[model samples]
Target: MTLRVLGIDFGTTYSSMATLDPVSGRATVLRNAEGEEKTPSLVYFGADGTLVGTPAQNIMLEDEEEAAWVFMAPKRYLGDGDFVRALPDGRVVTAVDAVAAILTKLREDAEALHFGGPVGPVVLTCPASFGPSARDALREAAARAGLGDVRLVEEPVAAGHAGLRDQGQRLGNVVLVYDLGGGTFDAAVLRRVEDGYRVVVAPRGLDRCGGEDFDRSVYRWFDGAAREEHGRSFDASDGSFNSPVLRACRMAKEALSSKPKVTLRGVLAGQRHKQDLDQATLEGLIDERIAATVRLSKDLADAADRRGHAIEHVLLIGGSSRIPLVTRQIVEALTEPRGLPEPLRLGATDFAVAMGAVYALVALDDMAPSAGSPWRVRAPGTVFRDVDAPWCPEMVVLPRGRFQMGSPEDEPGRSNDEGPRHWVEIGYDLAIGTCAVSFAEWDAYAPRGSERYHPFDHGWGRDDRPVINVSYEDVQHYLDWVNDRLGLTGREDRYRLPSEAEWEYACRGGRETPFWWGGSITRRQANYSGDYTNAVKWLGEYFKRTVAVRNFVPNPFGLYQTHGNVLEWCEDTWHKDYIGVLTDGSALVKKSSPIRILRGGSWNDDSRNLRSASRNWFPSATRLSWIGFRVARTLIS
Candidate 1:
């Protein structure tokens, strides 16, 4: 039950499988019999039975004419129009059936990796250029593999999904995926957003080009050298492409990725020969193929601009993309002559699609909330409780939705900084601290008075009381310390300050009114000055100073003292207005400012200042008695 879904990157040459546990929020990649996450995307039918993965790939050394029944790179045949490959049993099977057999083997491999029972929801990735028919075929393949409800995602989107927090963020706003695989080449353009990404332009692929083509080119070059140097040539018969000679060529290609030269040796046309091919020779043989792909990628970039997209970085994925020439070509394409960030060569390129597909699955699920969605909502009567870790502050699961982030012009006693109401969309769920971080949590990281201001807790009751008089610099240090202690890293799940938009979004808790509860707020619901109340006819209690967090009722999002207690710091820097802000619920940190934005009213602030749309700013290093901070969980793992 913990395994809610599975993601598979079904590639032409290699495939990988991964599973995500919703409850535990962890993912595991399944390795094959070879003790590797990627398995050969091949299948073979022998006299005894059918074989897939390493067994099939290892057996390629045997005489293919004798083995007879073999299927390699069946992905090349998909959507080729009226294509059906014959099985060894005299019955014919379509490309979908062959691919399904390989996928079925993958699931069996996954089931052996400490997981049992039927695999849950499945997402399969395909080349972006795949049409409706190809996608339909892909779904049918998944069905045959026991994944009946499989969903299809684009390859580049999945690649970006796997690296959004790391390489994706560094790639700027617009990104591209330059995937060169065994059977094809694909170039796509996508726009990065907070939660995931969006396709600005559909992918374009070269139908007749890929790694296999390059392999053929290399094989031909070696064949010619053997003919001239030793008067021998490789067989050009029906089984020549799959012969050991070509296999040697493939090995050289792989080895040459890291080395400058490789020695290829094999029997060819009744003649045994060995040839040392250097990088220069390999480049010469395949330069045209790579050049064609480079041109196509450049065209895709230009086409993206026509659609209002400006590409910032090109990410190289797929096993073939590991070639030095491929990386060099893309780097030159994106940034040549002038100094700029080079193209990204991802270390996780082989598994990017599978991991990214899992991310997409979880992200898409966040958008569609079920009636009893266990992810965002707790029981009706459930209230605030202590988080298990003593070093961490208590947190509440914030709901998912959109709301007006800024205030309207007509709102009462509103600041100009809060006007120009803009609609903000929150696509994912988040966990925010119930209140400002307590002195107990802050001191655990750094003792009182260690900061430049030499601030102290004053022993104003340190246990659950908000830790005030701390600068933004001190707060970030605290975040890094606690995040390191929690073993949180990478993009998705880490402790950090909430963005101004996110703070407002969670503060509103889906309410359109000025306060989470309604259009009005009161001193009774929060800690603030007692002279006036936003709620009419409601007598509110006055709390002149900080109270222990969760001392009062929580808002709809199960958070406490969101209106006042202490003004909290946000991830975004100070901006004069909300004009041209990111519509997605992400912090606006593109331009670093000396002053950072702060939200919520402090103990000395008026009730009008407690409105959800209220905002203010001060020096990043300023330490004040009324300024504190809370943390937000990205939950992206």
Candidate 2:
């Protein structure tokens, strides 16, 4: 019998649960009595000890004093040991207890759906940046909720598993998982093994950052506008205009996400405050916060290298990941000299994590051993095989051939990057890795030797996945190490990036279709966009980070996961007009500018940006989770 497991994502703004349904071979999200897929991670205690959610939010409007027991963002204080003190009644309640009450209610709802039977073991998901103490707090809360046998999984990992299950694909290595929640932001690097997943590194984020900050920026904008119009700022000190004003501000922010501008009309301080807020204005307000996120992501990627690993792809998850400005900033900060996959190819922001959770539940059950510790799994075989010593002359070879390089002129759902079709031929053959180089490969060549090969905390992924989070200088150094070990001169032109033409040529596989497989994109064809056709589809499965390199189908060139695993780097400097300048098959590597090219759409990307012709470029020194590279060698003819 399959032991059912409950998966919970205890988000700061909202919480959701899913359980494996044996009858369906699928995971079902447990809905509340109101038929909601998630419950607000909010708790309210009345003077009479009554608890509520939607009701509490509503009651807080009429009786602010009585609503003193209401706690909206208690999850944010989980490990801080903070407590909410109820006013008037002066009752002290621990954050853990408050969270427990919310979980207890969810447990009741799950029990009701299960016909009063125990739901079995529980799998709880937390932020990747969470430490042991934060995880312990969540476990304690689950225990109070009457759940036994709890196991902890990182939020991004759960989402990545969910994404893989949704597409019916296995997970991959060097996967980047970006989780931006209501109150916090986290990004992680993960690798997929034959049996399960392992975290390569856990990067921290601004605990006080996220969608709420964006909302506040919007609110502050409106407040500034109100002051300019009425000659007086709206009073939030008394809290009279707080709730309605905040609601209006939130709606406006959501509207600006899709629409260019939003209009807000309301009465504040007895004066009608009406204003039209455009995307530019809102983005300007939150630009600093967005830039901060990008910086944090890059710093984390750089830190990953200290541990001796590279980042290949970046997965964007959580509701806040949808902001256009946020996406653009991350792309700009992470884009490198090597060509990278297009940046914005993933799914809608709101559902990625929830969808990923469902996929994770199913995958865990499928991999669980018959008996013993439900948490651990036995490895099928050694993931590594001895390769030639580092600095050895191993080459990545691209065949001299012609392939359809762009989508057809009339292709449906096509984007600007996929157009202006043209083709060329590579007159020479090249040698490349039979598979992406792994951490083990790098360890074999580390200058300090094997004694220094002990696992580094920041370097992520297993030996089988493509190594990621490496810099242009780092890649060059690795190549140098390889050459030195093999007793070869570290010549400049001997090892280099494949030309942009080579990257697209390989990705297209002689086809003119939008994707390597030719037909319209579906989740099964690649590891991008949340599943749109399956139940896991409805649950939202695109990971917020990277996956293993072999998690999905490879292009016809015998390349693995060319489309949506991690963005591979190429040798050319970035030029918007490089396509016009390409008369030969080689990259324009001698440009005066210092930037580099990145190729291949990553797991976080949407389908549109994953097309064969999409282009992305960044400074050579910039490093990010989604940016990783593969090598190409000129064949000795």
Candidate 3:
């Protein structure tokens, strides 16, 4: 069986659980015995045994007389060793015992419903303010619940992982995490690194500020209204109405988050009180607390700025962050001041911490080869030859790293399309052809009249010259033939054209200069025409026609003729600019048209077109004497 791990968000008021699906590689929330994603963190001491989660919470609300037996928010008192409760039978329950009961209930339900037998590992999320004693108390609780050696992650950092992996945000971003839970509010600034996010500013929070405080404010509003209308002080603290009224107030607070108005109705001191609360009124009641949270966020951003890190995004998580006021105030306060974009609140905010813990767990365990840990089958620049092939293109492996995909504005041969230079990360094992596909290699697949296979070498000898007159549409048939020869016909580890981003990254060969060799190029470096030069000190002879694939010295990546061979075809559609392109080194495939991208200036072109970041495009069927391609193979599925 595959090793399955569980992520538990041990919240103060409610808790949630999640695990990664081994096949899909997605973190999914697990439903408890009540068929709900969230389980209440309340545990009750009953006559026969202990009751936990939704059942215990229900009893506490339905039967107000049993409130003394039910423990609430035991997470707040985790480090206080003197904190304990005595039952009517003279038995005492500590904070660790209550937390352990909740964890045991969640584990039992998850194992029976999701995991086939027992979960392999567990990672739990906690507040960043947790000290040594609190952390030790949580570990003890997990141990008592039969969980062996659980890893604890900070809630804000976990949410940052979810934003990057789950939400598909850019990998190298600086984000601010705003987490407002039921009993606490936290703000943290994190910078995305190659392996994981690093904390730029330590998390800061308020212990007594959260959704529970908002509930109390709403309850006070209703109490004040009741006193003004009836001319009497109506008290429900000691009556049967206490639990039901508090529950109504909490529900109203939650409802107003998405609704314009909500009607709160419950019996208070044997008199029914009905009130309609609008979002504006609730915002007014909680404005002070919300402002304080925003102040904390700004302070964290200021600290990051002092360290020369610009925050790119603001991610909102936790239940209380769903309020309209929270998003609006945060956006207004953080956007214009720092020139950052509006806050991002994608998907449901309730399960971000739990889901992020699972993502972090997967990364820490090295379960699969991802962007953080790419599979290294062989050494970089090592050439590999396929087995049993009459003639195969030698593929040289390239080291995975990040590079700028476009030219700078001050470059000698810059264009408008290359103005906004952006970063692209290539984190997979990619083996690219050491040279352009030669006629010798192509003839092995399409010798003569092999189903619409026509050789067009432009009068050049078909012995070792680079193949020309091939269109993007025609390259598919050649790929099919090569895959069949290598026995990779329908597998993910197959041969195909390189993506536009990957081509540029390989062409640069770890240099930011115009050419891979230096700041300028001459006839000695490439095969391009010397008629047009850009920042070159010497003008040398011009090669009027295509030469052999390996006629010149290889680039630093061990790839020859990358600068002035036939224009290589890329597997990307034409885009006007880099407006919304992904930075993950994948092709941006738009099916609206067949205008594909091409790279590397040919021997018939000027030297300006041979710059590393220069771009060109043509229709899929446009074949010319200066057009060809190089193949790339994925080392792993």
Candidate 3 Cα lDDT to native: 0.80
Cα error, candidate 2, residue 11 (Å): 1.2
- The lDDT values for all models are 0.73, 0.62, 0.80
10 residues in a row with least lDDT, candidate 3:
366-375
- Listed per candidate, the RMSD to the true structure in angstroms reads 20.2, 20.4, 22.7
Error of 2 at 189 (Å): 1.6
> Which candidate has the highest lDDT of all?
3
Locate the minimum summed-lDDT window of 10 residues in model 1. 378-387
Q: At residue 573, what lDDT does model 3 achieve?
A: 93
Q: Write the per-residue lDDT of candidate 1 for residues 375-395, one digit (tens) a residue.
A: 332211111222223456656
User: Model 1 lDDT vs. the true structure?
Assistant: 0.73
The TM-score, computed over Cα atoms with residue i paired to residue i, of candidate 3 is 0.56
Query: Candidate 1 deviates by what RMSD?
Result: 20.2
Per-residue lDDT, model 2, residue 192, is 62
Q: What would the TM-scores of all predictions be? A: 0.56, 0.55, 0.56
Residue-pair clashes per candidate: 1, 55, 0
Better of 2 and 3 by TM-score: 3
Q: In candidate 3, what are the lDDT values of residues 1-637, reduced to their tens digit? A: 2556788999988999999887788889999999999999889998787999888888887877777788888988887789998776788999999999999988898889988677766778888666445767898999999887477777877787787776556523788889999888877766666665555555666776888778878887887788787754344455323666767889999988779999988665677878899999999999999999998889778856755567888889999998899988897898667677778875968998999888766653332333444324433544444431336666777877999889888888777887589989888878888789988888887887677577687677887788889999889999998876555788776889999999999899999988998778888778887546563535566767888887776777877788986899999999888879989999999999789999999888788899989899999999899999999877762
Error of 2 at 276 (Å): 2.1
